[model samples]
Target: MKYNNYYFKLKSYARNYNINPQTKKYYNLDFAYLVELSKLDMYIRKIILELSLDVEHYLKVRLLNDLSDNSKEDGYNIVGLFLQYHRNAGADIQSKADKYSFCSDLAEKHLDEYKEPKKLAVWNIVELLSFGNFMELYELYYQTYPSFNYSDYLKSIKFIRNAAAHNNCILSTLRKPNSLKKFSKTKKLANILGKIPEFRELENRDAMMRNPVIHDFVTLLFVYNDVMKVSATKNVRNKKMEEIRHLFCDEDGRIRKNKIYFEKNPYIKESYSFICSIIKYIDKKNKNPKHTNFLQ
Candidate 1:
């Protein structure tokens, strides 16, 4: 929560430029990379989510374990499977075994890290991105897992995931002048994405989810913890980050209104887009890899 002097200097520089807070600091390669790196971290989260589901399903369907049978051995088996998959990808098994062994050792070493119940299951992904955002999370992940890119969905989905993680309800700065209307025109996009059967359902649900979130914090927190939700909230909180950034990191980096500088900037929107896109991509490809599929 404590900020150094550079935060105030960044705030002043941003103010003198008279640009919107969101548009500032983005000019810096480090922070901008941080933004994208945030997405990459959520990309990592998305990857973990599928693994959790796959591992859990493998246990339940294949091993026929019920809800009451959740065990550490099962968790270890899941990690074992992950190591197996990576090994099959032409990875050196000795290297892989050593790696997972370290992870196992580390997971036990930091068992208390999960005692407080992080916003995400650490394994749940989408929720983890919400609190820590992509930039903060991904840096940790990359520092942790450097040789993994087992899925192609990592890049773009990570971008959207970071966007959602940070609450950028509007998605991007690259949108066209009539982007909302254009997206409205593509009401079928949701149907295509299975977000809704039609525009009516999509709009209705979006409105239902949006208003309450803008006005309610608990509801927002609830949905935040649930990755399988239908909330259309992404990029909504980018405005908050933008405002805080420019307000504090102005022309000379002088802190102003913000009492605390966000060290763990969470880009929830990026996480959203990430999980959504992954769900869509996996659905289409799981059955047939050749089918042409796209999401906006």
Candidate 2:
């Protein structure tokens, strides 16, 4: 591979990594460091994608079960109501379903056999919807059922989910502060982190959440811990969390690889420590069921 061509491409996406504004120099940037960063980003994206899928599956099962048990109406009727409440979104979902029916047997049924929303089952409607569309349905359900408000958290997860799914670089701006806007920390996340002694300090929590990537990644962990109830999935989460730990640190919680790279960037190191702390907190909670009830 040509170094200049790859450097130009990297600069196009990660301009902040090209130079340090404080010193007005190249900021110790090099192709080898850039390659390691890309490798780290790829691992992070895989972790996010796997965990987000777990959350999405759990959300679908939990929501559908709750609605079925509580609502007086049948599944088809409830789906119809959702469609009627959000007609444009419903139309768009149906259009996409029709366009891709050839690939999906469920979509084909939704189009050919159950032409109207009233004839389609709630689970089927949910199965056909994308993650973003599913969140819209979740919001609509929340308005009526009045459960724990996950709107803010869901939005953050959606942003990260889409980015990971699209193979975007998550750590391009690790050293740069977010200049777009101030991120509003979710109360539920704050409450959960507050229980852990390491994250009890306001400054610690604020510093971690200020970075957009860290914020979303932590939110994903929060949702996974709070909603994923099945024992099997919990086991999967534990295994995956351990894998993430191995990627950056060892059993003694020491940086394993790219030590100098993380040392030079305080924000990146802090973010890594913050994530490890949360994972450790969660692992402890998982051991003792008495402390596992986070949001309650």
Candidate 3:
């Protein structure tokens, strides 16, 4: 395989850390680990970008539905609550504002920018809000939706996101190459979480939790499926999984008969099956045709 995408992105990131000739020192360049990390970061960035867009869209609809008058003032006040909540939790509001300004400027024509706040759009509002704060707003404002522990889900999503964004070493298997200890522990934790009656029947629970990265992807799939088209989200997920498998795995690592060879890494197979299970569950349960129209 050419590995064009991973090759280019990793090379691009590598350019930033050039070693100075004057202060030459041994640089243990783990090319393989760096490639893997790059791949994980690429996939996670896509997932987070998609999820953020979907959540922002949903919030727009939810706000318009919940608030009788979604004017510039009403929208600003409601979104201010999210910013305040995040600020109260010790987040640097100034940094967030900078990001908001940058993304908003780039996406100015497409976004519904608020004149009063000068480049503040609905997307910008949600963009500045942390996942935890956004979840708080979701729970408090969106009363019609079934509320789970948003904080728990937010923690997992944000933790993995920050690790990838900051280029942290997140691959347990890569670090501890010879052992499957983390894999086993992941399975146990997944099974315990999946035991909830709501998803008790979720298949391949053990396999789904075999890898931490895969588990995070599953969390993303669940959220995307709920907020977007079930079929579309599932298809996007399957496509990404296929790309990852081809990029990172040998032919032996591929799934057959809904199973991966234990000797080969089963994380991809388990993760795919887990996502498929959630998609199936959603399809079965979402009987209301009206629910499919998320924009409405």
Candidate number achieving the greatest lDDT relative to the actual structure: 2
* Prediction 2 TM-score vs. true: 0.84
lDDT (C-alpha, whole model) for all candidates: 0.30, 0.70, 0.46
Model with the higher TM-score, candidate 2 or 3: 2
What lDDT tens digits, residue by residue, belong to model 2 across residues 1-296?
Answer: 36433554355335445466788866656656666666767778888998899888888888887777875646676666677777765666557656755435565555654554336777778877878878878887777678765666898898889889997767776667454376666777767677767678746677677677788888888778777646757777667666666665574433447667646655566777777777777666767766555556
lDDT of 1 by residue, 1-296 (tens): 04422343233222111233786543223333333433433333343343333322222232223212544333334333333333332122222323565333433333244332112232432221222232233333333344321122223233333434453422122111112332222233224434533324342334322322111221222122222211232233223223333432344322222213222222333223233333333333423534322322
Give all TM-scores, in the order shown.
0.23, 0.84, 0.46
lDDT of 2 at 190: 68
Model 1 worst lDDT run, 10 consecutive residues? 213-222
> Among these predicted structures, which one has the highest TM-score?
2
Ranking by lDDT: 2, 3, 1
Ranking, TM-score, top scorer first: 2, 3, 1
Which stretches of model 2 miss by more than 4 angstroms? Answer: 1-9, 12-23, 100-105, 112-118, 177-179, 251-255
Model 3's C-alpha root-mean-square deviation from the true structure amounts to: 10.4
lDDT of 3 at 127: 51
Per-residue lDDT for 62 in model 1?
23
What's the true lDDT of residue 223 in model 3?
50
